[model samples]
Each structure stands twice: as C-alpha cells, then as structure tokens.
Target: MHLSEMTPEVDTHTHTVLSGHAWSTLTENCLAAKRRGMKGLCLTEHAPAIEGGAPSFIPHSQQMLPDTVEGIRVYRGIEANILDHENHLDVPPEYLRLCEWAIASIHSHMFPEKAKKTENTETYLAMLRDPYIDILGHADDPSVPCDFEALAEEASRQGKLLELNNNSTTAHRPGSLPSLKEYILCCKRRRQRVCVASDAHFHAMVGNVRPLMTLLEELDFPPELIVNLTQEGFEGYLRERITRLKNLH
Candidate 1:
C-alpha cells in the first residue's frame, strides 16, 4: 500500500482536443495510456468551461464510442464546470444522464466571483454529495480554496473519490504544492478514497502522474485508498460507480 514501484492502472482525468484547450486527440490519448501500461483512461472532455469547449451535446453523444479503444478501456465522460455557488453545473441534466462517468471541477473562470473560503467549502461539499459526480477534480487549486479537513470528512461520508491532479504538481497551478500536500494528508488521515490523475492536456502526458506519485510516496500515502492503483481496484470501483448511477433518481 505504498507508491514506490507502483502506478495507477487508470488515468482518471485526461483531456482530448475536444476539450478545446487540450492538444491531443482521443486516439492519441488512448495510445499514450496504453503505452504507459494503463488498463484504461477516462476520456473527459470539458464543457462550457473554455471558450470553445465541447458542445453540450457532447456527453450524450459519447455513447457512440466503443467501450474499449486501442486495447485500453475508454470511459466516456465529461469534466463539467461548476458554474455557480448554487451547485449548478454547466452541462445540462439530459446530457448528464448519459455520462458514463463525470468529474465536477471548479476552474478559475467558472467562479469569477471567487466566493469566500467558507462558501467555496460549501460548494465543494455540495459537489461531493452529488451522486452523479464520481470525483471532484483538483480541489487543491489555490484559486478555489476549500477546507481540506471538511473535504476529507465529507468525501469519506459520501464514499466518493477526490482527485489528486498531477497538473497541479507542476507549474500549471503555481503555489499549489502546499495545498496539494494538505489535501493528501487530510485524505490520508481520514482514510478517504482518492484517484490520481495526469490531467494531461497532451498525448504524451497521459498517465503522467509520477510527480503526484512522488508526493504520495513522500507522504507515505496509503495505496489501498487510491482507487486506480490496480486494474481490479479500478474496475471494482467502476462497477460500484455504474451501479450508483443506475440507482440515482
């Protein structure tokens, strides 16, 4: 249950050209995941976040894709923007219903008001409570601050995973190291589940979670708490996720 000499079997968060700001195609992303020995990756396109992000119809339309591509299991998914403090998502209900998996994230642009730290905490807690959302992407972002302890407690209660975004470990999210460490520590202390994601915007970066893994290794984070560390672990989580979606109203 350690990070050394081990890698997550699935890259839970990734972007394709369809996300508007990313540089890779779905095919390229899949190949990269396969090369990295990933059993699969979630093809999560952004919606209503970037200026030219994927259309609202994109999520439901993803059903056209095969379950597996390039020998890698492809989970049709969307990274929906959390538009406001009311817990509203940019992707509408109809499209949301078709998403095989979904990530709800707060981008800087999504909440220009940048509500108070307490409000952001509430917003995140609301997201974690959502049955449709499998994970909350990059809550460590300094821009949208949340109380890490509160997040850890709520995520544990909800039985959902919190994202450890590798993108934040790099210069992409400046000054994020402290917050990311706090997030890891809180989750570890609470014995909460998590998923490490590359958050790759390019083909070559798929499954590129080494930096975050290094951080986890340094913290001695528990591997059993990470849902994607092994194929069986991830697949088991997926089955639970699919069942959760089906049982939702």
Candidate 2:
C-alpha cells in the first residue's frame, strides 16, 4: 500500500509545553492525533538535561495521565539527553523506569563541550546499552554527527528503533536529508526497526509525517520495518517493554 494513502498508526515521538519549547498541550496533541486517524501518540517530553526542558517531575508523574486520551491510546515517554561518552542520561534510572518508552538523542546544548564523531558514536553506543532506551531520535541531524551504520547495527542487535523524524528531515533541521537517507538505507540493510515521527511541537502538526512516508515510499522501504504502520506493533513494543521492566525487578 502507498503511504500517501496511509498515516502512521502511532507517532512515537512528540513534545508538549512541558518540553519548554513546544507549543501544544498533551490533550491538544492527543486530539490532533486522533483527528488525523492515529491510534496512539507518544508524548515524549524533553528530559531535564536539555536547556529549559521538562522538569524531573514531568516524567515521574506520567502515570497521572489517563490510559486513553481523546479516544486514542497515550504512551508517555521522554526524549532523554545523552550527556557524554560515559552514557550518562539527563534523567535518573528511577525516572527512566517510570516511562513506558524512551528516545535518546544528543542535544548540543546539554553537553558541556563539543563532541567529535567518535565521541558522539561512543555516547550513543553507550545509551543503547541501557535497556530503557527504546528508540534513537533524530540521529539524522547533522549538527550531532555519528556513525549511522554503527548505530543501526547496534539498534538492531538491541531491538531498539531508529527514528525517521519528519521535522528533522523536512524544515527544522537543515542539511539532514542526505544523512537521513543514508541512515534509512543502513537500517534497511541491517533489517533494523524504524519509527517515523512528526516531532511536532504544535497540535496541528501531530501525526503529520507525510514527508518521511513519501521518502520511504521512494526508497521502496519495506513496511515491516516501519513500526508505526501497525497499531498492534507499536503498542506491543511498549507493552513488551513494560513487561520486561517488571521482569527485571
């Protein structure tokens, strides 16, 4: 089926006002996702490590939200900052355990110093080693360069997903398409999981991943690799992850 005629069942990455920079409310985002025909929405606020990002209490209080919002399943998560090569995350392990899913990304503002490609790659490798990290968000952004091939292979081995962020590839992040295309190719080649995200800051942009969908279609990328296409697959990942966390206790 052509993606132009389809929308992802779940948008695994997004932000609300709690992120300190985004424009929407969690309720508004959920409404928009439902209106756009999405079965699920992951509200992944930026972790505290980010400059002016979410407060530590935000992730800790995720359970206060209803399981379903505006008739759509709500998955609460965090876009955690990868602090350094040591794999330090902005959120503590206790808070990380509270999240249903987690997407780790390197925000330059969070780092004390500039990191080279080798350091960036090593940091991500370390982050993926943490089982709480379920997806890698916007590795396509050139500002935080890393070895996509290495990341894709590691994500595959760890059963983590690499995101194809719509905002990063389209307008917000410039000069990212070439690298994003390469990352997608690497994921396709390694048979790794991929999540298409709008990374929407506003309510209207939720579930708006048409650009990445078109690109995936152009590449003839297999649908099976795209986890957002099926609601069962998307939500199943969270359920399985939560279960794994419980088992670990």
Candidate 3:
C-alpha cells in the first residue's frame, strides 16, 4: 500500500503526560492524532528505568483513562524498560496486565555502554519469547547493539511485531540507520510484520511517520507487511496477540 492509500496510520508507540518527561497531556495527544487522521493511538508511557523517573516499579491506574477519544481508540499501554542481563521490566506483571497492549524496548539510560552486545540481544530475544509482549519497540537501535537477524527471526517465530521507530532515525540517535535498515531487511526476509512508530514525546510528534515511510521506500520494504495499514488486519493481529499472552499466564 502506498502512503496515500494507507488509511489511519496507527501510532503503536507514543508517550503522554504519564511519562514524566513527555510534554503532552492525554487530550492533547489524542487531538494531535485526530488531526493527523490516525484511527487510534496507543499511549505508551515510560515504565521507569531510572531513579525518580515515574517510579521504576509502579503501574499507572487504567481506571484513570477515558475509554475513547474523539471516536478513536486510545489504548492504555507502556514502553517497558528492558533491564540489563535479565528481560525484566520495572513494572510488574499485574501492571502490564492492565494495558491493552505493551511494548518492550531498550532505552539508552537503562542499558549502559559497558553492557555486552550479545547479552543485550539475548535479553531482547527473551522478551520476544514472552507471550505478554505485543511489540518490540526500536529493536534495531545501535546503542543497545543487538543482532538484528536473530531478533527478527524470534519476532517472526513468536508473532510479535517489530517497530520501525522514526524518531530514533531522525535525531534521537544518529548513525543508526544502517542498523534499522538491517532490521527492515531481516524482517522482510523472515516474512515478519512490523509497525512504524513516531515514538513521540509530545503532541505534535504524534502520528508522524514521514521519516519511517521514507526509510521504508529507500529500503524497498513491502507495505502490506506493516500492521497499521488496515483496521481489520491490525485488530486481527492484536486479537491473536492477546490470546497468546493470556495463555502464557
């Protein structure tokens, strides 16, 4: 599907006011997504990895969110921080269970430079093996330094989606495009699916996929393999994911 033909670019990874560092409120984020013609936006706040950063282990109360926003579904989710050596997140299983979806990712602050590249890949692979994880956000980030082929294969095997993070490509981390491209190619070769995320920290950044789209074109990626192209297909994928996660518990 061409970018113009793609309806409702669903941003599966986004941060809201709940994320201590994010600048936008839930309402503002939703409004921004609406303006961008997004069918839905998942508010994935940071699962704290550092001290005094939204409390590393506490989960947000889901009852605090409105069920819907401007006719678009607002999924309560979190970008759970991947700790070193272990695939453990700061938030507990009960907290993760409250979310409609969950994205596991490696943030620079969480994984220090001294960490082993192979061990980092192992951590991600273990997370992918876990049925609770729906998506692996920004798995190709060079700072974390993981083997792209292995991660992509595990994602394909487990039916978990890989993320093409646009923000990381643009400015968050420079010189990582090669790694991201490798992930894209690996996913393509493995016949795995992926989602393009803005990984937005503010409202204006919500639903922005220009960077990711351009990269996909440059890589000659198949649009049909991305999950956000159609609502029916996306939901079907989500349903299967939920069932898989539930069975794990």
Candidate 4:
C-alpha cells in the first residue's frame, strides 16, 4: 500500500509527557496525530538503561494509557535500553512482556567509546535474534558507532525491522546524517525492510516522519518494503519475526 493511501502514517516510536523530558501529554499527542492524518501511533516510553533515564521516572504504567484514543489505535510500547556489553535490557522481562511491541536500542551509558561500538553492535545483533524484540531502534545514530552494513545484514537475515529515526536526525544525537545514509544504502543493498520512527518527545512531533521519509524517497527506496505501510502487513511481518526469534532461543 502506498504511504499516502495509508494516510496519517503509523508511528511505531513516540514519547509522551510521562517521559520526564518530553513535553506533551498522551491525549495531546493523539489529537495531534489525528490532525496530521495518522492512522495510529505507539507510545514507546523510555526503558531505563542506566541509573538515571527517562523511563526510570514513569515506572511500568501501561495501564495508565488507554487502548484507544480519539478513534485512533494507540499501542503501548517501550524503547528498552541496552545496559550492558551483553546487550541486556534494563527493564525486567516481565515488564517488557506487558508491552504490545518493544524497541531495543543502545544509549550512551552502554556505548562509551569506539571499541564499545563494535561490542554494542554484536550485542544488538544478539537481541535482534531474540523473539520478543519487534524493532531495532535507530541503529545508525552516530552516538553509537555500530557498523551499519553488518547491522543491516543481520537485521535482514533475522527479519527484524530497522528504524530511520527523525529524532536522531534532530536532537537525541546530532550530526548523524552520514551514518544514516550509510545505513539506508546498506538496507537497500540487502533488500531489508525499514520502519520510520518519529522518536518524538512532544505531541507536535508524533507523526512527523517527513524529513526521513523524504530522505528514503530521495534514495529511491521502495515503499512496499516498509512494513508499517499497512496494519495487516506490519502484524504479519512482526509475527513471523517473533516466531523466527523464538526458534533461535
């Protein structure tokens, strides 16, 4: 399905007021997404990685977020932090099990230097092999020096989705364009599918994949390869991925 036909895009990664650093409420974000014509959105709160992280403040309050909002489906998700060289999650597996979907990513605390980048990449690759991890968030962000080609190939082999994050381009980690380009090229070469994430910290940013979406188009990316273009397509892809991961474990 074409993205415009899908309309108001399905954003799989977003942050709400519950995240201390974020500025908008969940309802506000839902309303904004509606205005932007998004079919659905996921509220992926931060999963605490280190001693201090945004997720540490909210705790596991999935029950606090309604199942639906303003006629749009809102999924409860968590961007779990990779806290160790082993690529272990900071949030307990029990808490993680409660989420409809989970995005695992490396943060500064876990990836400190260049050598750590290689280690973190291997660790993330291992997590991608995990049945429960639905998406691998922002693999190209410069803050973590993973080899994009290797990561993309691994994701493709495992059938895990990679993210082209808008926020990674804007703030969370700046000056990431080159690395992002490399990652995109690698995905194209491997025929790997990708998901675009807003990584929004406020309501206004909820459905804004324009910047990265444009980049994808510029690179001549085939829209059919993006798993989230349609609800059924995404679910099927995710289920198959989960099964694949489960077999690995």
Candidate 5:
C-alpha cells in the first residue's frame, strides 16, 4: 500500500521537550499528530538513564494529561534504558507501571562497551520476557548489535513489537541499513508483528514514517503483520496488550 493510502494509525514513539534534548513541547507534538491524521500518538520521553532524559516525576505525573488530545488518543509512556545484558531497565518497575506502555532500548551512550552477539541476544530475550516492556525500540541501530533472528524469534514468542524507526535513516544511527533489512526479513520469516515509528524528536516529524513504510512495501512485507497500518488493527493490538497486562497483574 502507498504511504498516503496507508498512514499508520498510531505513531507509537514520539518525544517532547520534557525529554530535555528534544525540541517540541507536548502541545506542539499533539497538534502535529492531529494534523497528520493519526488516530493515536504516544509521548514516550526518554527515561532518566540518558544524560538528558526526563526526571522521575514525569512518568508518575503523566496521568494528568488527558486521555485524548485534539481528538487523538494520547498515551504517556517511556523509552526506558536497558542498563545491562540481563534486561535491567533504568526506570523502576513501580515507575514503569505508571505509564500506558514502555519501549526498552540499548543505548551505546549509556553503556559504551560493545557487547558480543550472544550477550546482545540474551539482552533482547530478557527484555522481551519482561512484563512492563511493550515494544523494543530501534534494535536495528548498529552500535548496539544483536542476533536479529534470535531476537525476532523471541519477540514473536513473547508478542512484543519490534520497531522500524524512521529516524534510523534521517537522523543518527548511520550504520543501521544492513541490519534493518536483515531484521525485517527475519520478522517476515517468523511472521512477527512490527511497528513503524518516527522516533520523532520534534513535532513536525510525528507520524513521519513514510520511508520505513515505503521500504516495507518494496519488500512486499505482509501488511497484516504490521499493527499500526489501520486504526482497528492498532486498537486490536492494544486490546491484546491490555489482556496481557491484566493477566500479569
């Protein structure tokens, strides 16, 4: 499907100035989401592990934001830092429990040592099995390498969504191209679900995942496996997540 014809129902990973390093305010971010025809948007500020990430109070107070902003569903979440190979996250479990969803990532800036493929694979597997994390962010970033096939298999088994970040091409993360293609191909083989996100640091970039979507089309990736392609599909994804969370609690 064409990008214009199939805009993702939710731009699942977005950020605001509360993240400190990002430029846009939360209102600006929400306005951009509404203008882009997105049915939902998530303000997933970077958790405190990063130098300029949000303070602890941010996630705890996110309940104050309305459930919907400018007619778009808004979710308060965090891009939590993966502190080690054993799936430890920067945000505490109680703090994580306050958000609607969470995306766990391995940031080389936080842990500069390059991990072996086995170590990286284990990290992804452990994070996938965690109860709080709903999505895995930018596993394609080359600086933090992993065994894509192994991660994809585990992600599939755990019902977690692996991200195809648009900013991986336009922004930092230069060495992402080869691994991105490989991981998507791996997901295709395993029939795993994936989410296309802008990983937007600014308001204008929200819902701007056209490049990733175009790549998906070129690969002839199965549309049914992409959860955010349509509103109903995304709501169904949310319903499934809710069920899982309820069972966890």
Candidate 6:
C-alpha cells in the first residue's frame, strides 16, 4: 500500500496550552485529531523543565481527562526533557511512572553541551534506556545533532519508538530536512519502530503528518516499522510496552 493511502491512526506527539508555547486546549486538540481521522492523540505536554510549561503533577493531573475526548482517544502522556547524559529526566520517576505515554526530548537552550554531537548522542542513547519513555521526540533539530544509527539500534533493541516529527522536518526546525532524512533512513535500515507525529502545538495542526508521509513514501519506508500507522497496531505496541514495563518492575 502507498504511504499516501494509509494514515497513522494516532497522532503520537502533540501539545496543548499546558505546554506554555502551545496555542490550544486539550479539548481542541482532541477534536482536531478526530476531524483529521485519527483514532487517538497523545497529550504530551512539556514536563516541568520547560520554562513556562506544565508542572510535574501533569501526569497525575492528566488522569482527570477521559479516555476518549471528542470521540477519539486522548492518551495521557508527558514530553519529558532529557536533563543530562546520565539518563536523568526532568520529571521525577513517580510522576513519569503515572503517565500512559512519555516522550523524552532535548529542547533548545535547555540541553547542556548543546553543539557537541558526541555528548548529544550519549544523552539520547541514555534516554532510550528509560522504560517509561515510549518515544524520543524531535531528534531532527540541526542545532543538536546526534548519531541516528546508534539511536535507531538502541530503540530497536529496547522495543521503543523513535519520532518522525512533522514540524521539525517541515517548519519548526529549519535546515533539518537532511538530518531528519538521515534519521529515517537509519530507522529503515535497522527496521526499528517509529511514530510519525505532527508535534502540533495548535489545534489546526493536529494529525497533520503529510510532509513526513511524503518523505516516507519517497524512501519506501516500511509501514510496519511505524507503530501508530494503524489503530490496532498502535494499541498492540502499547500493550507490548506495558508488558515490558511490568517486567522491569
């Protein structure tokens, strides 16, 4: 099947107003996702480390939302920040443990040793080892380059997902196309699982993953390697991740 013919069932990365820079509310995001034919959306507000983002209690607070909103599932989750190369995340383990889905990212100005690719790669490689982090958010930013091959291998070994962030590949991170393409190629080479995300900060952008899909179509990336490509597939991955997490504890 052509990549154009299939839509990712879930918008695995998105944000609401709880994430300071975002412009929409949870209700708005869910409605948009549903309108765009998505079966679910991950409510991945930034963790406390973000200057004007959600508090650490976000995970506990997310439980207040219903399992489905505006007729589509809204997975309670957090986009936790990778604090250092020591596998440390800004949000504490207790709260992270409460999240249904979690994304670990290195935001601009927030990551130390920023321009150092070696250190950056080490940081991401370490984050993948965290059981609670389901995906690594937006590693395509050119300012923070890392080893995509290492990341893909690590995520595959751990059965985790790497993100193909639409915003980063398109508008958010300029000069990122080449790097993002490289990242995708590495995932394809390793046959690692990935999640195609809008990384939408607004309601209108929810489930808008066309640009990345176009790239995948061009590369002939395997749809099976993308966890959220179908609702059943996405749910199955979540179940498997849950079982794996359970084994860890």
- The estimated TM-scores of all candidates read 0.95, 0.94, 0.92, 0.87, 0.94, 0.95
Q: lDDT value for candidate 6?
A: 0.85
Q: Report the C-alpha displacement of residue 148, candidate 3, in angstroms.
A: 1.0
On residues 207-228, what C-alpha lDDT tens digit does candidate 3 reach at each position?
8877778778777787889887
Error of 3 at 105 (Å): 1.2
Model 4 — TM-score against the truth? 0.87
lDDT of 1 at 184: 91
Best by TM-score: 6
Off by over 4 Å in 4: 1-8, 50-60, 113-115, 241-249
Model 3 has how many clashing residue pairs? 0
Q: In order, what lDDT does every prediction score?
A: 0.85, 0.83, 0.78, 0.74, 0.82, 0.85
- In model 6, the runs with Cα more than 4 Å from the true position are none
Q: Score residue 30 of candidate 3 by CA lDDT.
A: 83
Q: Per-residue lDDT of 1-249 in model 2, one digit per residue for the tens? A: 797567998988889998899999999999998888889889898878776776564564788889999998988788888777777788888888888889988776566554488888878877777878888888877778889888987887877788899976666887888988888888888888889999998999899988888888888788888888889888767776787678778
Q: Per-residue error at 141 for model 2, in Å?
A: 1.4
Q: Write the per-residue lDDT of candidate 6 for residues 31-109, one digit (tens) a residue.
A: 8877878899988888888888875555666788889998999888888888876768888877878888889999878
- Cα shift from native, residue 73, model 2 (Å): 1.0
Off by over 4 Å in 2: 112-115
How much is the lDDT of residue 27 in candidate 3?
Answer: 85
For model 5, the run of ten residues with the poorest summed lDDT: 52-61
Any idea how many clashes model 5 has? Answer: 0
Q: Residue 46 error for model 1, in Å?
A: 0.6
Per-residue lDDT tens digits for candidate 4, residues 78-138, read 8887767766687676666666788987766455653566786788788877667877888
Summed backbone clashes in each candidate are 0, 0, 0, 2, 0, 0
Candidate 3's displacement at residue 187, Å, is 1.1
Instruction: State how far residue 225 of model 3 sits from its true place (Å).
Output: 1.0
